[model samples]
Target: LDQIILNLVSNARDAIEDNGRIDIKVSTGSSEDILEHNSIVKPNADKYCLLTVSDNGSGIDEEKLDKIFEPFFTTKSAGTGTGLGLATIYGIVKQNNGYIFCESKKGRGTTFYIYFPESDEKPSEKQLIGKETKPDEQVSSTDKKILLCEDDEGVRNVLSKMLGAAGFNIIEAADGEEGLRKFKENKDDIFCVVSDYVIPFKNGIELYEDITSMSPDMGFILVSGYSHDVDNIAELNENRNFSFLKKPLKPELLKRTIMDIAKHGND
Candidate 1:
């Protein structure tokens, strides 16, 4: 569920080259009103749950919309991006017994409507993301500083709030390049780095490689919404001063990871 949100938001961010608005709205309706021109959405849904992400970015051309969900079929420049974002979103929604539809015009921006069959079963709290309803019960905080690198503004805000409430000072970066710069500037003071695996300019691996070369004992945590990032880290063949977490972080889980790394730094 978190991966779905991250991919859609990231795609929207990439679409807008300049200032634009992205609106996320949720509504519910009967299957009849929402399902049209698609035979797949008819049988499985009685009522539908709609999560729409609308963006005022450079919209897709009619010719390209059909191929948008195809894996590795990106229109981005070479060495810039992957078509995997949309393809992953499509697969996740479908696996949850849902469907995704896109509406767009060349210059009018785009909206993606995701329909999920409303389910009565709520995931147990153990499976929930950002599980901080019991904040007082969370791991204690420290005075150390943490470097947070993520390109998405909304996600960065939420994470900052969570970590700040836990009593740590956060040094922020919008992308991998800025993150590396800050690391160099504050190398002597920072206790650890918590960064997204798929960041712009330079990826988490590059940042990790460069930083660990300079401060081999500095604690590092690499995160991403993509599972294959795990495979990438595995290729490194050594895991020291390093750990990883999948995206849509649970609050207590993140707090524990950070505390552990900070403790290691103290040692």
Candidate 2:
């Protein structure tokens, strides 16, 4: 919910070149009212929470509305976005047992409504403080082997070098298919699979599934420029041992994620 709100706000800000209005409204609606008025099925009895974000910027066309939630689908220019914002939000909300609806008309405005089932359970509060690390302190990799899969050559090179410098033995693959092949060949030597979500042949999720079947205890990390339906990733994080890092990730973040995986070995 927090992530989705951030993405929507960021997108609205980008759409408006100058000053514009963005309205965020939250309320509770009865199940009957929601079903009749919003044309959405209520997940439970009584009431549900409704969150609506409206922006008075350039509105989307009707045709594009359906595609906005798809991974890598974007109207923005190259280097502007990875088109994973909405997709990621969609995945998150669904995972949390929620639903979303969007409305827009060209030259008017756009509004997104998110519905979440009401719960009597109190929300748990936990504050995450960022780990402090010194710049001079090098992250050691302990001769552990890693299967690195990334389609972009530039990103691939930088990541491989960074991991290699940390003392990891890097086995590189350009796409998912190659990643799987390398994993099979180096099953004994490899300590983890670091892969990009979007790739050729098969996707990161599919690769994760295949690798887990062969080596259930293997560690995996998924990196992506945009967000997607991360239910599988979340499940793996909960049931097995894996990590996910969003793209444009700093070196420190990557190091921390790897170290976390190495230390904990999943829940």
Candidate 3:
């Protein structure tokens, strides 16, 4: 769910180069309405949670709209895009039995509508047991500072708020370049770095390599919405100072990982 929102919003923001608007709406949708956009739905579910992301920018050409969700298919020039964002979004939505559709015109604008089936089942006893727990008290407070690197503003803001409410000082950066710069500036004070696996300028691995070279004992947590890349990083698994998490993040898990790293920073 987080990945869907992050990638869609990020793409919309990028499309709007300047002085453009992006709108997000969430509402209930019916199977009949969703069938107009997607044909694969089995129609076993009657209701869905509709997510709409729209941008008033230089829209896409009809010819390219069909290929937007294909891996490595990009309209942007050269090194600007990997084109995996939309593919990832499509795969995630489909994996969860959801439907995604896009509408665009060359000069008008673009809008993406996603339909996720609404489950009527209530939470189980196991899930309900911890429903009232306080997230802030789940992990011990630390005097150490954390470096947060993520390109999407919305994701970053939510993460910052979560960590801040847990009583930790946070230093934020929008990309790997700025993250590296800030790490160099406050290398002495930072206790751990929580960064997205994929970021601009440099990736998480590069940032981890650079920072670990300078401060070998620095605690690092690498996160991602994509799972295919996780198996390739054998080093992250071997390193005692490093950890990885998949999104959408579980707040308790993130907080516990950070606190564990902080408590055992010198070990």
Off by over 4 Å in 2: 1-140, 265-267
Q: How high is the lDDT of residue 87 in model 3?
A: 90
Best by lDDT: 3
Local distance difference test values of all predictions, in order: 0.79, 0.78, 0.85
- Against the hidden reference, what TM-scores do the models get? 0.72, 0.49, 0.73
Residue 87 CA displacement from its true place in model 2, Å: 18
The best candidate by TM-score is 3
Model 1 misplaced stretches (Cα beyond 4 Å): 17-19, 121-137, 149-168, 173-181, 195-210, 213-215, 223-240, 244-267
Per-residue lDDT tens digits of candidate 1, residues 1-267? 656776677677778867788899999955775557365545476887888998988898899989999988776668556667788789888788888889898777899988888887888877676444564444444657889998868778878888898899899999999999999999888888988888899988888888999998888988876667566667553665688877555556777888777766555
TM-score result, candidate 2: 0.49
How many clashes does the backbone of model 3 have?
0
lDDT of 3 by residue, 1-267 (tens): 766776777677777867889899999998998878777756558999899999998899999999999998987778656788889889998898888899998777899999889989987997878566566434555567899999978678878888898889899999999999999999999999999988999999889999999999899999986657666667676888899887656666898899888768644
